[model samples]
Target: MSSYELALDRRAKEIEWENDTCDQYDYRIAAFCGLAAGVIDALFVGAPGQGALGRLTDKGADALVQKIAVMLWKGDKRSSAGGRPRRAPDTLERAISYLEQAFPVNYDARYAADLRDTGGALSSMAAKNHHLLSLAHSPDLIGLIFSILDQFTGGASFLYKGRVIRLIPVKDARGNKTAYMQGTTFSSKLFCGICNWLGHLASDLCGSSSTRREGKTGRGAGLPIPFYNLLLLMNFGNFDGASFAELAVKVFEEGYDLRHGAAMAVPVMVEECSIKLIWALKRRFYAGKDWSECIPSSKHADLRIMLLVGNAALCLVDAADAAIRAAVSGGSPLTFVLHLNLIAWARLITLIFKELRIRYGAGVDGAFAQYLAAAGLNDAYALRQYYERMNRLDATLEQKLTEFVRETEKEYERFINGVNQSLNPACGTPRQRQEASVAFARRHGAAPERIMETPEQLREWLGGADRQKKR
Candidate 1:
């Protein structure tokens, strides 16, 4: 079969196998798993400062920051007090300080006045929410690009008040400009920039160097949650006279940074794993399904629906908890919104999009399959094999026919030569003998009336003559 036909056949089968139907039981199980996950979220993954999981994630993040700082540290190993080797960043504060000095940037603006003094138009920028406003501080692809760009160009980029602004390089207290991406070649400069970006991120992941050094017990201004900087563009909503962009900044200032974002992911992970595990177990134990068929993959229609239902249930519970808490706190809309698990809602949104894509893809595949069937090309592989076999057989028969024809011509020539010799025993030359033989044959009608009458008859006569001569 042609490659296109083969590909169509493969795709049709794949769609068929993946189109698993979901029943009421599957949905019920999914909802149950989601509710359980929501309970976990409510009990242990609440607002950043008031949740056990949040605190744990915060500590973990601090440890990670310290670890990265130790790896990047290249300062003096000897202690100042004693001439002995000092341990690598024994404390998180020391780690933050070391990284801050190692990879310094010119974008450390603390307030609107700092930007205004530098001729920037971001009036609302502040130290408390500057990480969220700065595009280079994000942990996503946008952040990476801007981080590299800022390092290469010696400028800071910020998205503030629904507008993008770039500020010139700021001079340090010693009046020396901070060098960024210190390298001679492009490749070396790129490497230095990447290292600088990563080191800067580690330095700010927990909190700023100043905040850590001040011995602050609060969740000091850490880096924004991954991709949270994009939320600054959502300036449309008006909750209590505050736009969504403002609210996002407010949430980040209230310790809803990367550590808190990590905490929020716990319940979503639980919901996803719970539904998939339960579905896989049920298929294997109760439904008598094979191991391959029992896999709880998202490609399966049933699993996709189950995940959607599960995530939706989780979001519902999270919204309810946030609403009740907000009501208890005197019906503050911002509080309610802040308490909502944005990660869970995001997961639900992605699940919805995936379900829609799957449905649309199924429809397209069905139409293609029908078209192929109507064209009678569904069995193209078998037809192609049959034609190949017939072609081979025809070639073999033609080769054998050519050999038989050549042999028959040679036998006829021999028979004519024998007749000529017998007709004229006393021969002068071969030409004289052949002429005499022809004259004798015409006069006596000795030759066969039609030598080319039937190929089968000629073959049979030749065979019989050969057998008689041998005997």
Candidate 2:
């Protein structure tokens, strides 16, 4: 029985044991009601003290427990009263709670499961299948999830050296949970939030890229706040079912618009298939513990690489995102760069925020402001050289690559140092940077087999492709 149930039983007994039946008020109302809580309190919190109903038959036990739970629920609701002030739980917290309820895992259950296909298949789908709204501010919802996620503090342990992998369950998806240990480091969590926010925004069906511009100003001005606002919204809800595939793709195709000065490129954001592919991979993997084992370390390493490349790709993606705005208006480099750079800057904030959390802890004082503590980009020049070399080695890669250099600042310096060391001692080619770039490109799904061999030759293919699109 829950604490509420124990209280109910005691209250009932107090009413039954009433000596003064002649007068109902004389029986003591407080005595009657307080008994209910006394009886059930031990049941929920597991402190101590049992009520008369403790030894009841199983059926009666069930009934009494349910009744007490109902009363407690009612009391809890009443206690909350008309929207008083309180902090809200976040999506991740709620997700953790869902996992707890579904798995009902405890510290003793600190075990690992295969991560692959673990998402929907294993889940009973009851508690773990709710939509975790990201930025749209569901305070109560957020608060609830956060409360749930709290169950993992010092409770579970994983085999990752001394590291603990707290798996977060998928709310909307049926039978799975994510395997990645929640990187509680400020930087990791912050980046995760950014990803989550991006998801929330993208899932919003009500808006499109057009929201960035909506007004009666010049040819294209206002930056359709509504559209972007809705864009942010759609990203939170699950777009997993087959129908969303067509809808997302169609909408993306319609909204994709990027420009360079006046030179607008048609479909720069790559197909929705790409983003969908990421989610699909997530869906296919992010289950339990086994997923980490199933995916090769090389693939995992490559994703780390992709995260880097993707950030680098963002320079272009940022430009592409800007293109969406540009598509609405005629175009200008200033507006394009302004919007692009602004998002890039947001990415920078996210990056810096993430690195701080990783190096220090998120709980450090004023975590959000930690970027001020980060060293200035002393390695930007080296990174610039790296990029120039990489691009020169394969111009197509110039278009395809994206990197998150902020986090790589130290690494870039280290790489430069190593290169300098290897060169003077034995003597080597300056082209090694270009050679390294080629190797890095090959690591990704780069099938530069024919594409790199002849960019000029592909002009015919590109021409044909454009003609087909136009038709």
Candidate 3:
């Protein structure tokens, strides 16, 4: 079979269904199944905090998975109302019951606690249970869901009105793929919004935030309402429409279709680090000592916590970077730009780490050693030395980072120019303006000196002639 045919075959097998002539309903069900299967697999393989069975038994599981089932159930109900047959109401309940029985947990107890804690209102459950919410909506978990969707949907790229929209896979400063997961591609507006949201999360955590300029809640601002609602259900995942339109034009002009999605994963990584750093700082701050003040009577306890968390965050970044490098070994311009941008972010965090360390006395090393001991690193001395070396910021490195920042800014400007040109072809180019001026002069039957380059120039000439007439 051809590759496309093979893909379809594989998808059918994975989804455990084969409908050669499927309607929109079947497609929707397939999408839901792909997502649910991904979530289930992730749970089995160890989702956020809980083990496989624990996920089904906990309030988090009930809140996330059951709600998903409820949504599908609602969709089925609507389909039935529209004259199509619907699945039984008990379908979702049965699934939940089976999961509970499989786990052999006291469902009544879990459900009672869930009701008591949530007050029987699903509306505020997410806010009240942040740990569960974060786990359910983690970037990795969402990314896994995306992977599964790719299989069920025939490709990662989606078809809307016969056009295939895909998120352009990211590349780094060294011309390497930022993420090389299967089916990754260029960005659509929705994908861009996701990236922007991730960026917002990172920026918010680190006390630095880019101006939104365009008023938009990170939720499915421009997308259709139903899809936006789905995103909310996922709880896993931006700006103005005009800015996005410009970005789309620019990306197209640059021979790339990559959009906001390309920009998102890096920020998520950066923000993950910033979150830990912020937690440590806030803990210290509450203890009656600011970074500017003395290291409080608590000594450098907060600093140690910050280091441990920061180190863990950095380790994740390293792993992500390695994966990116592996995907983009030979390098491309896109990857090079992405690499430079990501490196600047990573370095900024490192600088923050150093600043914290300098504020605390050398005795802070004792806390760091404890972290090393807890981590079970045999070479405490070597690990400390390595961390210090990595975290240290020197004059030359700082200068280079500044240069990278400037270059990245220029590249963005260039992309924006492309967007402008693409969006308004006639008014977009200087050459087009010149041609337009010539055409206008021809239409007016202008004499040799009749035409002026601009309104200001014409005004200047008219003023000169009036003065001559007075003379």
Candidate 4:
């Protein structure tokens, strides 16, 4: 009757059949059946991920149907576990029509003996294969078996300890097994590690990677292990201690909750474009040639790739910076830093996409700093870091970017002061404005007095237009 029930029951730990009144085990079988039935019914109504429209893309209601259906048929417990067959006889579209009979979830009766009979059914189907039967008996394999089963039969999300988590089976190249649960929120630390690992995949680990960074094989060859290490450290997406939910909300919300004791916030957007761009870059990078070096043999491409990737990395770093700033500003860097997360997500994805002219991503290292400047992130610390990363990778562009930030910060200070005056009409007034100006100067590594009042003065302190003369 309720949707959560349909999604949450699949995880083995949640269903307490031994003590849950009626046979929970038997009911679980029925739940699986109901899931199957739901998929069948969804053939007309649409299920979660079997189609393009299932998530981000809108390839019609049946977008991923082919992929989902194929995986489901191969996941049959009644088949030998030695390995799945390479193909299936019917298209998933056709199979969904019969889902009601095959995996019906409407009643408790259907699940009772379905999987209980799988071992026997599988052996019969396998021509009495003994080796296959033994692998089927392994407990760890059962979870994978069930997850694949859930993907096709539908109703995969389930509640554990009062939180909802959807089951998604993900695979890296080489067919190594991994899972992703969309909408599964975790603390900043865990998210950071996941971000780092995934980020490495597109930039360093992909097939085309040739050069090495900070030791270890090139980014391409080393991806799986680092990703796994990050995941293991994270205990495979099982985050137990932090309440990142508040952090999540704050990162996305319009204002920080600083009126109490928390810092003020920057705004967040619900819709995002990171994954799309990242994948696009992947296509380009693999196409060959270091697009980032396209400007000339001697010049960095000032490539957008580095800029975008650097921006995304800033999302993680900014959160840390925001926490420190929140203690002072009425707002947390997080409120504003959320922009960085989206940028980080987008950058990781964009880094995957290769630029047309060159490869190795335009030679702009620590890409996000360029993005921060481009996005007009005038925060002193966030800006300085961008220059720092670029200075390490490309001196010419670093000088250019540094000049640009210096000029922009000078302009932005006035604009912000105007906005502040309009919003807070009373108390402190111009005094707070002056203090903010002074603080902005101090943060920029600017001089204390005159630099606070005049943006031009701050620019001069940063070596301004003169910094460009040497170039």
Candidate 5:
């Protein structure tokens, strides 16, 4: 077979594999896994202030904040007896205070009046929800960029009331409003800005320094949920009397911050791991499949569908639990909405869109587009190279196959003309013409015995002429 024929056969098999749907049993197992995850979320990851998992994550965040603070505390001097720093910020409060002094930003404004004084327009901004309003306080790429920009420009950037507001030349601790870092080269200043950004984030991860100092036991204002600051830009929806941006701020104020975000991820991780594990186990033990075949990935149609089913089930259960709790607690819409696991729903929505695209999109072309879109091409350069090579190979095979077909047709035409010329009454007898045709068949790469066979046999011989020419 030619390379083109082999490629077509492989593509057919791939399409068949992709189209393979899961059976009822597989879907049932997926639902069971999802229900189990939902149970875990309901029992352990309810509202941020109430759930056990939320408290655990809060403690973890606090520990992380303290570790970062200690690392950044350059004031502690090394002891003569040992290399360890002596009298390091001994408590979370002390550590936070050290970081506050070490990395001060100009944009620590925590009230509407503060923004007004800075000539900014974020009136709804306050200490309780300032972190959510401030884009630089987020823990994402946008946040990083804004953080660096604010550091360099001595300003703050905030998204509030469906608009982006920038306040420039804000005063720092020294009461001097300067744009660039003093007494440092460009590179040093840039490095310092990054360190300051990270250090400030650490300081605010648990709560403000003053809040810690006051010994507040309540969930004080911390950093916004990872990427949740972006949600403040989604100012379209108006539930009750507030837009989505206001709702996002309200959510952050009500303890749906980064620590609570961590807690929400638990059920999402559980559902995903459970689905993959059970799928692998069933393939290995029940179906007696090879270890390689037992690897559960989204590439498999059945596994993808199973994941979709599982996430759907998890979201369903989580929503139901939230609804029931809300009903019991005087039926507040915000309360029910806050209880719902946003992470699980996000996962389910992603799976649904993926499944739809796979099923209804342009097959291999669509899959390739999706791969390119999702893959970090800068990091996955090897994978990008592999795809380029495959594309080149396919083009070469197609070109060769086309040339072979055209050449075969021309050769067959020439052979028929030669045979007809030999069969002319003026040239030879019947047996002589038949001998001439037999010689033509042998010249075209067929065995002499096949000369007298059917036309199919003769065409098959002609097809091999290209392969023989290559040799």
Candidate 6:
């Protein structure tokens, strides 16, 4: 017999019926009742020195645990009268505990299965299927996660690269707090809270200090702010407004210093930021009102086109640079990786342009048209076809990998040449070249200079007879 049964037997023997006239059967009945009562009391109040509910069955103990868990989750503040204050577990601790119970991951079982099947196909497939199923509960999971986050460390903050990015709300002109995402930076000067990713306060989503310095009152000061603010509002706040403007501004205006100040990895960062902005704009487009009114004028549109096209061109330059560096270093061919990256960029550009066309009603500004013409392309439609052909989902991976290299290289050379021609009018016809030369002369305060037949002769002449005197 178990310890309880043995204790009950001893207790039954100790029970005494004290009535003198009582029979042996009556005495036995009294002892039996006393033993039964003792066992029942032990079951109700638990055994002495046993942890929590040691006398209770497993089911009973688990039920009690669940009840306590529910009470804690519900933030029950009840305490015994005249007892010490109720010291409940913290919100994070409770949330984590609840999550563990709700989503029980059997890592040991998974590991054992993986070990048994060396290929791990069965375990991997099972994990993938389970992950897919879990997605259905994403909305609830998100809420729970936010709750946990809110409970810990005060408020909403994105932890990136081991740094906490705390966003402080900004105040507008009327003294009311405007919603903004400001990071904890050393500078006292306020930046566009949302666009401080450049790690400076000069240029961002809202306003720039450069505008104040340049004495530029109208054009560059706050032109993109309204658009970016709208985007930020749509992304993080209530979805109001009918039509949103296209988010094409000068790359430098958006605080991307790709030329003199940028690191080698900046192009990649720019590409990522561009992709993020594109997504935000897309979301705004889908949910908001009609965008016809918010459409930029031809001049602003040209700048925007330049920004987009320039970014696309830079992506090509970056790829070429990577390839050249790899070749020089005798590194393995990163052809597959490069192709995949280009394909993704192509897809993003295609989507952004397609949406812009749908919203704006026709072609992109004269800038894109001129750019295409200079690139020796008769039609911009052909470029669209090129992008679409490469981005075909039905195509095999091998085909994509092959086409990305061939097509991108061809397009890269053409676009780069076109960009060079646009920047340097000397690449154009004689009359156009002469006009560009005249403009350059006027800008540099050059006294009426003639266009020489050869640049070498012009340079030699400009050296003058005074060169010997200097020597």
TM per prediction: 0.70, 0.19, 0.20, 0.19, 0.69, 0.20
Give RMSD to native, each candidate.
Answer: 25.0, 34.3, 28.9, 32.9, 22.3, 37.7
Candidate with best TM-score: 1
lDDT score, candidate 1: 0.75
Worst 10 residues of 4 by lDDT: 259-268
Per-candidate count of clashing residue pairs (backbone under 3 Å): 0, 64, 23, 47, 0, 4
Question: How far off is residue 209 in model 4, in Å?
Answer: 38
Q: Estimate the TM-score for candidate 3.
A: 0.20
Question: Tens digits of per-residue lDDT for model 1 on 1-471?
Answer: 899998998687568557777899998999998999999888898887689999999889988988877765545464546422256787888888877776766565566554424554666667788788888888876676677777777677887665567776455212357634578965577678777777778888888767776457877788887877766765657887898778888888888888888999999998999888988898889887778777766767788889999999999899999999999999987788778898999889877766766667657545655775675445433423544675686578668867988999997886776575745566567556655555645655566663323456668888989999999
- In order, the Cα lDDT scores of the candidates are 0.75, 0.32, 0.35, 0.32, 0.76, 0.33
Q: Model 3, range 229-258, lDDT digits (tens) per residue?
A: 112221110122323222222222221111
Model 4, 1-471: lDDT tens digits are: 477775775333223312223233323432333233223222321211222222232222122433444555566555445333444525433433322123322111111131222322222212111111211111122222322334223323221222223332233222324322222323333343233222222221111212221243311111111111111111112113323332333222221111100111111111112222332354357434344422221122222333333334334444544444455655544433332223233334544554432354555444655664565433433424544664465456457767888898977986676556534556266667666656655655754554536556656766856777878
Indicate whether candidate 2 or candidate 3 has the larger TM-score: 3
Order candidates by lDDT, high to low: 5, 1, 3, 6, 4, 2
Task: Give per-residue lDDT, candidate 2, residue 95.
Answer: 24
Error of 5 at 324 (Å): 2.1
Instruction: Indicate whether candidate 5 or candidate 6 has the larger lDDT.
Output: 5
User: Which lDDT tens digits does candidate 6 get at residues 1-471?
Assistant: 999998996565334211113234333433343333223222332211121222232223234334544554455344444222244323322322442332221111111132222332223223212111111111122222322222222233322111222222122212234322333531221232211212111111112223222344321221111112112111111112211111111222322111111122223344434433443343247535235322322222322342344345544544554455456656433321221123224434764675477457566745577775675444333534543564463246447666877898987886665455435755887656555555655544555545444556578777874697688
Error of 6 at 218 (Å): 50
